[model samples]
Target: MTKPTETGFSAPEFLTVDEAAALLRVNRKTLYELIRLTQLPGVLHIGRSIRIRRDALLAWRPGNGGPALGESR
Candidate 1:
């Protein structure tokens, strides 16, 4: 979950690529492909590492009558 700080910036709960892939029920490679296609939410790059927000992954359900992670609200 993300928490609002005194500076008004949110600190989102970030998950590793492997963890995110497991939550999406897809392999890591597939998740990477989705990220590449812009269908999935983009990763947060911290130096040489990448991370995804857990909330975004939870919101990404296709055919659920709602927009996906990176879609416009």
Candidate 2:
């Protein structure tokens, strides 16, 4: 069973690129770059669309040890 996140989304919930970018407070381009580099986790390709798992997105940290959340990158 999936647990509910603070946003009321279940752990298994999928978020669009816009939604995921908004949650991370980053621009869509940045998110897309991460996707392009295969840095982001839980990325799913459905047809020509993309979906990211809410849980995986929330748990992700910059693999390169980039700036902390809420700080300028």
Using lDDT, give the best candidate's number.
Answer: 2
Model 1 residue 2 lDDT score: 75
| Candidate 2 TM-score to native | 0.72
Predicted candidate 1 versus true structure: per-residue lDDT over 1-73, tens digit per residue: 7778779998668888898888778899878866765666646879988899776777866565645544666
Worst 10 residues of 2 by lDDT: 64-73
The deviation in Å at residue 21 for candidate 1 is 0.8
Report the C-alpha lDDT of model 2 over 1-73, residue by residue, as the tens digit.
5678779876647889999999999999989988876779999999999999988998987764765333555
Q: Write down the RMSD of all candidates, one decimal each.
A: 8.1, 5.7
